[model samples]
Target: MYSFKSRIRYSEVNERKTLDLSSVINYFQDCSTFHSEDTGNGIDYLTSQNRVWLLNSWQIIVYRYPVLFETIKVSTNPYSFKSMFGYRNFMIQDENDAVCVVADSKWIYLNSDTLRPVRVAESDIASYGLGEKIPMDYKQGNIILPEQRVSKEPFPVVPANIDTNHHVNNGQYIKMAENYLPDQFSIRQMRAEYRSAATLGDVIYPEVALTDTSCTVCLASENKKPYAIIEFIS
Candidate 1:
C-alpha cells in the first residue's frame, strides 16, 4: 500500500470546515504518485518516455468527514489489471483511525504522443510487486451504481472548461457538484464515471437531483445522452 500525510488547510475545506471533494482528489493523487514511485515507474519516468496514464473512472465511499487540519493517512494498492487498464483501491483514514474515505479507480496506460492506449507487459507489472493479479470478481460500489437520472438545456462550453487535450477538465465537474450542495452540509463521499468526452462545440447541461441523502448529477448531451455521471453521499 502507498500512503501520504494531509494538512487540512482552510483552502482545502468547504465552508463547513471539512475536507471537500476537491481535497479528496488531492489526497488520492498524492497516494497514486507514491504508488507509482514505489513501483519503480513514476509519472516523471513514464512521461519522460512519452507514456501517460489517463483516468477512466472512480468510486468513493465515505465513512466520516475530517475537520480542518486533521491529519490523514491516504493509502492505495493495485487490485487488478486488464490489457491497457487496471484498478487501484484506496483508503483515507483520520487520526482516530476511522476510515474517512474508501475509493477504487480505473486507469488506462497510453502513448502520450498518440493518446492511444497501450498494454504493459508482464515484466512491467511484476516490477510493482503488487502481488496477486486482481481477480475479475471483486465487488465494489453500490448495486446498479446510481444511474444519471435527469438533464436540461445545454450551456456554453467555455475555454476554461477545456483542457490540454481539448476535453473538459474533470475537476470542474466537481465544482459543479459543489454548487448544488448547501454550503452548510458536507460531502461525505462521492463516485463518478467519466464516459464520453466533451469537446469545444459541445454544449453542457448538468442535471442534479437528490435521492434520500445522496445527490446525483449528470452532464447531459445536447441530444439528451449522458456525458458523465456524478453522485454525492452525505
Candidate 2:
C-alpha cells in the first residue's frame, strides 16, 4: 500500500469546521496520483504516452469527519485490474489509527489521442502488486431515483469547472450534489456514478429527491438523460 500523512487544512472544512465531502474526494484523488507518481507511472509518464486515467465511479463511507488541523493518514492500493479498467481502494485514518473514511473507486485507462479506453499493459499492473483484498468491502450500488423529485436547479458549466480533461472534474459533481442538500443533513456515505462527461458551456439540470435520512441528486439534461447520479445518506 502507498501511504502519506497530512493535516486537514482549515480551508478544506465546512462551516461546521469538519471536513466536507468534496475535500474528502480531493484527498482520495490526490493520494492516488501521488501513488502513481511514486511508482513511476505518474501523469508526466502517461501524458508522454498519450494516455490518461478517468474515474468511472466512487463509493465512499465516512465514519467520522475530521476537524480542522487534525492530522490524518491517507493510503491507497490497487486491488484489481482487468483489460482497460482498474479498481482501487482508499482509506483515511486519524492520528490514533482509527479509520475515518473508506472508499472504493473504479477507473478507466484512456488513449488521450483517440479518447478511447485501451488495455493497460500487464507488466505495468505487475509492478503495483495488485491484491484481491478490498478495504471496507464497499460496493458501489445502483442509485434509484424517486418517481418524482423534490426540487430541480439548472446551471451552466463554467470555464473554472473544467479540469485537465477539458471537462468538469468528478469532485465538482459531488460538490454540486452536496449544495442541493438541506443544511441540517450531513453525508455519512456517498455513491456517485459518472455516466457522461460535461464540458464548458454545457447546461446541466440538477434534480434532487429528499428523504428523512437521505438525498438523491441527478445531474441531467433538460430532456432528463443523466450525466451523473449521486446518493447521500446522512
Candidate 3:
C-alpha cells in the first residue's frame, strides 16, 4: 500500500469539523498521485512523454469521518491489474488503524503518443505490488448513457464552467449533480462515464432518475444529446 501522513486543513472540513464530500474526494485523489517518477517529474512530464494514466471509475466507502487538525494515514495498493486496465484500493485512517474511508478504483493504460489503450507489461505490474491480494471480484457501476434519462431542467453552459481544453470541466458535473441529490444521502461514492464533451456556449439539459438506494444523473445537449454522466451511491 502507498502511504503518507495527513494534517486536516480548516478549508477541508465542515461546520462539524468533519471532512466535506468534495474535500473527501479531493484528498482521496491526492493520496494516489501515480506519476512514473519520484525524481520531481510531474504528471504533465509523463503525459508529455506520451504515457498518461486514465482513470475509468472509483467506488469509495466512508465510515468514520476525519476532522480538522487530525493526523491520519492514507494508503493504496493495486487492486486487480490486467491488460489495458488496472484496479486499485485505498484507505484513510487514524493512527490507530481505524479506517475513515475506503476507495476502489479502475484505471486504464493510455499510450500518450497514440491516445489509445495498451496492455500492461508484467515487469510494470510488479512495481505496484503491495502484498496481499483481495478477491478479484470488484463492484463496478455501469456507465449510464446520456440518452437514457428524462429531462427536468435545461441550463446553458457558461464560461465559468469551461477549462483549459475549452470544454466543461469534470468538476462541473459534481456541482450539477449536487443539486439533484437527496439531502439524506451523504454521497459516499460517485462513478461517472464520459461519453461526449461539452464546450463553452453550449446549452445542456440535465436529466435524472431516482431509485431507493441510488440515483443516476446526466447532462446532455439539445435534442437529448449526451455530455456527461454521474451515479450516486449512499
- Greater lDDT among 1 and 3 belongs to 1
User: What is the C-alpha lDDT profile of model 3 across 118-231, one tens digit per residue?
Assistant: 888765566555445433334655775534556787888899888544567555766777788876776766677655668878888888887777778877888777676778
User: What TM-scores do the predictions have?
Assistant: 0.79, 0.94, 0.76
Error of 2 at 183 (Å): 2.0
What lDDT does the true structure give each of the candidates? 0.72, 0.88, 0.70
Question: Over the full model, what C-alpha lDDT does candidate 2 score relative to the true structure?
Answer: 0.88
Q: Taking the tens digit of each residue's C-alpha lDDT, what string does model 1 give over 1-234?
A: 667777778888876788777778767867887888877788677867787776777777666768898888887888677899978887888877677778777888888888788997786578665643322233465324344455544576688777655677666666665666644555666777777668787787777776667777787787757677777767
Clashing pairs in 2: none
The residue-by-residue lDDT of candidate 2 on 1-234, one tens digit each, is 888999999899999999988999999999999998888888898899899989999989999999999999998989989899999999999999999999998999899988899998986666677756555756646778788796565999998778888889999988888888897898988999988889998899988888899999999877878889999999
Clashing pairs in 3: 50-112
Model 2 TM-score is: 0.94
Give the TM-score ranking, best first: 2, 1, 3
